[model samples]
Target: MSSAPKNEIFTQVVLEVFKVGGLLNIDGDKLTKEFGLTASRWKILGAIMLSDNPVTVPEIGRYMGQSRQAVQRLVDVMAKDGLLTMTENPNHKRAKYIQMTTKAVDIYKQLDMKQVKWAEGLSSDLSTSEMESALKVLKHIAKQISA
Candidate 1:
């Protein structure tokens, strides 16, 4: 067989990154399940919590890089579960703004605590400076890939 191309190394790196991301997600999902939340629903709750203003479903979809319908479904389920509330959007008659409920807010706080512990365990050996540098490099790579 012919020798592998130089670009194959980059491809292999990307694949490994995705593989690790998937593993992280699986662990996250297990944690979320303990709170009676799915991975996607927890992600929506997180987005809402991080936003200072009410976020539209479409805006959430765009931020999460998911389809609008998929985000809407998550919103609907959360609303039904009393985890979120939907308000009419004045800017868009058809669109609704989503906000987390008090229950969700409380749960999010618990999740945050768990996440802190998880981070501590995962980076037990890494210094803050190392973590910062890693974050910077990942951010740069994300920007380049998105661009």
Candidate 2:
């Protein structure tokens, strides 16, 4: 309850969050490697998949909490690889909307399956309530950090 102890606890929690982020990055790359996706590519794909409609690169960037330029470069490479296609945006003239190709959708599905298995294995020792509690804490921290 003392200020110093509270500060130490906050510092420790922040350090743990950073540690978890680094580990998750490595895990994400490893899990997506077989699907020819890196963590970045997989993340963009996920953003697109979760979008309500085909979205512009800027929108994707916003959704992913990344820069538009970074998302645009990734979109260009993905388009070249035939994972997605850019179409003229009805809402915006210069900015085009991105949509996944069938190939991309199939790949996403495979990735989702892999994620399910990977998560199950990782959470095998943790109870559902524990996982939920952790999720809540993380989400709260994320909201605070963003704010």
What Cα-based lDDT does every candidate model obtain? 0.86, 0.90
lDDT of 2 by residue, 1-147 (tens): 466787798788889988987898899999989888888999899999999887999999988888999999999999999998989988899899899999999999999999999989999999999999988987897788789
> How big is the positional error of residue 145 in model 1, measured in Å on the Cα after superposition?
3.8
In angstroms, how far off is 19's CA in candidate 2? 1.9
- Model 2: runs farther than 4 Å from truth? 1-4
Question: Which candidate ranks first by TM-score, i.e. highest?
Answer: 2
lDDT of 1: 0.86
* Each model's Cα RMSD: 3.4, 2.2
